[model samples]
Target chain A: MSPPLAPPGWSRWLVPPAALSVHLAIGQAYAWSVFKPPLEAALHLDGTQSALPFQLAIVMLGLSAAFGGTLVERKGPRWAMTVALVCFSSGFLISALGAWTEQYWLIVLGYGFVGGIGLGIGYISPVSTLIKWFPDRPGMATGIAIMGFGGGALIASPWSAQMLESFGADPTGIALAFLVHGLSYAVFMALGVFLVRVPRPADRAAAAGGPSAAEGVRVSARSAVRTPQFWCLWIVLCTNVTAGIGILEKAAPMITDFFADSSGPVSASAAAGFVALLSAANMAGRIGWSSTSDLIGRKNIYRVYLGVGALMYLTIALFGDSAKPLFVVCALVILSFYGGGFATIPAYLKDLFGTYQVGAIHGRLLTAWSTAGVLGPLIVNWIADRQEEAGRHGSSLYGLSFAIMIGLLVVGFVANEFVRPVHPRHHLPAPPKEAADVQRQQSA
Target chain B: MSSDSSPPRGTRNGLIAFAWVWVGAPLGYGLYELVRKATQLFTG
Candidate 1:
């Protein structure tokens, strides 16, 4: 093949499509919950048991991203995107085989383990690249890519539901849906690979290692751990995700249970609607809330996400079991913030550490999500499960969980407050503007 | 964790700046609303 035409522009535009492809495809993980009731009913599994696929996916997302960060950064976006596509699509295929065989563990292994790798790699691939492209607006660039991740569920949720309805809820049907997903996504993600391009030579030469490089925003992964900023962000994200996922994991039944004896109760259809609304908010948060991080500074924006998010959780815990509209709205608002937290975090990382090795640092940071994924669900589900066994009704079941969430938030708030400027020793000056000069010379 | 700044300024195209604002605003507004509502839940 002829020498690859030097990708025109900063090749930054390629970053969004690349990020979105992985995000949108792996986003199918969020739709795992919709499959649980059917799987449980069909296979006679318990709620906890059926949740394996999603939990595994979340776990894998963190693990892969953590390990793969360096690979993506070194190998370049093309390699990373390709790996994401294959693993993600293959996970579906394996899960399809499991569905056909009525082997639940196969589903767990295929969709959860193998597929999780895709989720993790796909997540980190575009972030560092985007920062490289938009050194001036690290927050905005990362936000755009991350938004794709949050929004992917919007398309996947309904699409999965529809597929299941058409295919029949049995082993054969579920398998068919999984098969279709695998095939379709391979095609979708391929679009990204074909389109993506690394930064041109001139651009790299121009910077010659500057501070503004989004990669340089933070310390090296090793050094980063020693910094307070990383831990502060960890607390902020963990708490925010914990609060949001706390509500999201229980969104359907949580509202209806609260209203079971209330003056105005939530109907089944309304519960479904509530789930849909939350999805909308989740998608919107990825795009809308994160981009905001660009303007306001990632640190200040996170303060709002954590501090305000706490209060919302408190409202639902305190008064949620009473008012129907208030309960629904507040929970949703919290979920939106939760989605925003995921979307905005990359930008936050960019602000703290320079973009050098940001992909790796971000990969490391996502271990926080993995931790929260377990913590959030366990706290909510375990507490509710205990309450149900103890003969408590409605509000009492969630009181303890909500209280725990509040404490997490308060802790997170302190973490956010603890954030100080990066110590000077870790500093890397911004890349000099040679690319601009080159462009000026070319134009003149 | 350095208190350093990098001005790796790319081409100052109004095009990119315009695109940034267009995309960033909605995200900002969404976050602002979430915070505003979370705040209002108490004060309002």
Candidate 2:
């Protein structure tokens, strides 16, 4: 289908909400933990078995975004949003059927494989459109949309908990809840599909007149992966995410363990609170730090994320057990940087590669997230397990992991320093008149 | 391509506000719930 082109004076402000509709719906993936306990009890499964759907979903999110990105670019935001809506909402319905029937693999296939494609496509569908709309404030524009992904769990967690409480956590109730989610999100995401529009070519050309246009260096996604700059960014993103996600994945347990030997032992309720606080920080950092990136530039902001983030880990490792308040503050800052890293990266890609196929490039870059998603938890959990085996307790169990995170951050910092503008040879040559005419006609 | 057929300024303004409210209301509720939960970190 031809992408919808905006008439002159369609307010740019409308785009963020359109983007949010899909993001908030797909972002519910993070709230999978709320279902874990119930699913386990219902299916008589272990933690790892219950976690398979979420893990597969995340892995598929990366793979689909990488493979489907060019298709999204060619098809436009409306097509992408519609596809996301169909897949995401239907995945929930299929999961509902699976729950009712007590078939485990069906749940994985639905929520993990199909729903994950929705997540991947929905995540990037708005990115290039927003960047195009708000060329003057690309960081803030994309940040607003991406922040919804981080904040989605805030809504889904409490809502899901309340539903489970009301409906009971049995297979029937789970099926009912999934059914509701499927129908409701289908309705919500339809708004985005209806509202999205691509900037007209004239508008795009006008926006490209800015100074940072890098003399019109429009790197295609295939070519973008070839540059040293992309790999450097890959390392930068992987390390930054690895550091933050390690603490995030283990927040409740890590906090409790940090103070296990102290005067103020953390209660279960307080650990839950700590996790909520980190979620707030993560959401806030997406809008806050990414907007700051608009003013200070992407590279300088990442220096803070990596450099200052590593220092926060060092402080937590050394003095965390003694001071609860200090530990919380350090962790909050680090989590914020984690979120900021995600929100800011698309703007960073726009800066380095220009906006040619930025959505596709951004899609490919998310492989770093998939990598860190596995690596972060594995590092923290594996090390903590080994330390437990060695008779370590409290803060000692996590000190080695914290130190390793510091090393990883240092590596990321060096990678960020190595990033330069893409070479001119990588830039796409200007399209021939017939091709440009066909593109414009298709968009029209 | 400015058009005389465009909606009036007030209509456009109303749309902008409505769109923000559609997304913002849910996000606000989520944040309020999160803060309510997060308070336990200090009080608990």
In order of appearance, the predictions have TM-scores of: 0.81, 0.95
Q: Identify the leading candidate in terms of TM-score.
A: 2
Tell me, by lDDT, which candidate is best: 2
In order, what lDDT does every prediction score? 0.74, 0.89
Model 2 agreement with the true structure over A1-444: per-residue lDDT tens digits? 788888777777888999998898899999999999999999898999999988888988999899999999899888899999998998899999999999988899989989988999999999999998877788999999999998788888888889988988999999999899899889988879877888865566455453335425689999999999999999999999999998998999999998888888999989989999999999999999999999999999999999999999999999988899999999999999999999999999999987779999999999999999989999999999999999999999999999999999999999999998888999887567534743565465
Worst 10 residues of 1 chain A by lDDT: A1-10
Record all residue pairs in model 2 with backbone atoms less than 3 Å apart, i.e. clashing.
none
Model 1 residue runs over 4 Å out of place are A1-6, A37-49, A101-103, A201-218, A388-391, A427-444, B1-44
Docking class of 2: acceptable
- Across A1-444, the per-residue lDDT of candidate 1 in tens digits comes to 111222435345545655666666676677687788778877779998898887888888998988888777778777788888999999999999998999999999998999899899988877877766666666666666776676566566667888899999988998999999999889878766665555553454343334233433446666776788888888888899898888888877887788788776667767766766776677667667777877787777777777777888799888887677788778777777787888778767776776667888889889889889879989999999999999998778899999999889889888988888778687655345644554554464
CA shift of A92, model 2, Å? 0.2
Q: Kindly report which residue stretches of model 2 are placed more than 4 angstroms away from their true locations once superposed.
A: A205-215, A432-444, B1-10
Per-model interface RMSD values are: 11.8, 3.2
